[model samples]
Target: MKVLYLGDLVGRSGREAAIKRLPELRERLKADFVVVNGENAAGGFGITPAICDDLFAAGTDVIVTGNHVWDNRDILPHFQRENRLLRPANFPEGAPGRGIGVYDVPGGRRIAVAQVMGRIFMDAMDCPFRAVDKALAAYPLGRTVQFTLVDVHAEATSEKMAMGHHLDGRATMVVGTHTHAPTADHQIFSGGTAYMSDIGMCGDYDSVIGMQKAEPIRRFIHKTPGARFAPADGEATVCGVFVESDDKTGLATRIDPVRVGPRLAETMPEVV
Candidate 1:
């Protein structure tokens, strides 16, 4: 199975760029399933139902989120009704949406997507390890299912890496989100899991992680909030990781990075 897991979409520029580029990307890459992190899709914080619908119309099969999942307040009800939109599973009992979702891919294949937020440097949440274990236990690979993707929405790279190792061989791909900066550690583990520290944000590269640089700079240098946060107005890029998995075991056979549009260089994987 060929899966394209995109980084977080931030702000209008990011959303527009994704909606503009995703169709061509899907065709060029021949992706079977597409999962995009939409936590920051609505003006760089939290996703709205409208944005989620736009993403679906633009070819996204599953949408995952993190801490900013509930930023809009309006999305709370949508989270309850939507099957494709997922929030961090470890949030808390009675949290709006589920963390894991099982959906059909193009070839009538079942793909399960799970999102778990890490506790380190993030809001207090249930144990990610336990949450993931429980979610995976419900859908064991190679027997009942074929493909599984885990979006570890986290801040600390160490914790994300630990989660990746913990789920090695159990999932088809284990990709990290949050931090908004793409990492260069894309690799397929010996255990057959495709992993990346952070897929980064699909937004302007000139800004500070998708937001206008001035505010973050001000907060860093002056230690005060002067204005509301806004998405950077610059050329946007769609960044993330791509993985191809085995049909029988649902283990990753190939893994690569994707960076397209302005500011970031474009490159494709040269399968060996």
Candidate 2:
């Protein structure tokens, strides 16, 4: 099994990056499944149903989100109907959407995807460690599911690293999002789980993170609110992680970083 996991989509530039390049990416990566984080797709705040549809039409299998998942109130109602979209699993019970989604791949194989939030420097939520433990227990790899990945969206790198180690032998991969900047660590653990501290954002790298550079800079220098934040509309770099899993055991055998655009040098892994 092969999975391509994209980091947070910043906004127009990010969304456009995926819509325009995703099909080619899938072909180049030879990915069998694709998961993208869309929390920041809507003007860098919240994602909408229409945006999700575009990503799906572009060959995305599942969409993951983070702390800003609920920024746009319209998504709450759609959550009940769209199983492909996911919020953090650690969110309180009765939350609008689910975090765990299992979809069929080929040859009767199944790929399970889940998202969880970290509390170290992010919004408070249920214990992500416990939440992920329960989730992995519910679906054992190579038995209950052919492959599985858990997205740990957090700010603290230590928390993400800990989670990666905690679920080392359990999940096929443990990818971190929310930091926007991609980390250099992409390694398959001794237990077969692929790990990356962050996948990086898909948007214009020229700006501050993904937002327009001016406002963030002004606010930082003046210590006062400036204009509302907006997504950087310049050329975007598609960023993500690619992994190839063992056919029978469904454990990751290789992992690599992917980045393609004018801002960052291109990267693609030999896989699947």
**Candidate that scores best on TM-score:** 2
Q: Which candidate wins on lDDT?
A: 2
lDDT of each: 0.89, 0.91
* Per-residue lDDT over 1-272 for candidate 1, one digit per residue giving the tens place of the 0 to 100 score: 88898899989988899889899888778888899999888888899999999999999999998999988999999987899999988988998989999987766678999999999988899999999999889788876678999999988999999999999999999989998898989999989999999988899999988899888899999987689889996889989888998888999998889999878788765543
Q: Give the residue spans of candidate 2 off by over 4 A.
A: none
- Poorest 10 consecutive residues of model 1 by lDDT? 263-272
TM-score of 2: 0.98
Clashes of 1: 0
Structure candidate 1, residue pairs in collision = none
Model 1 compared with the native: what TM-score? 0.97
lDDT (Cα, tens digit) per residue for candidate 2, span 67-164: 99999999999899999999999999899889899999977889999999999967779999999888778789888898999999999999999999
Clashes of each: 0, 0
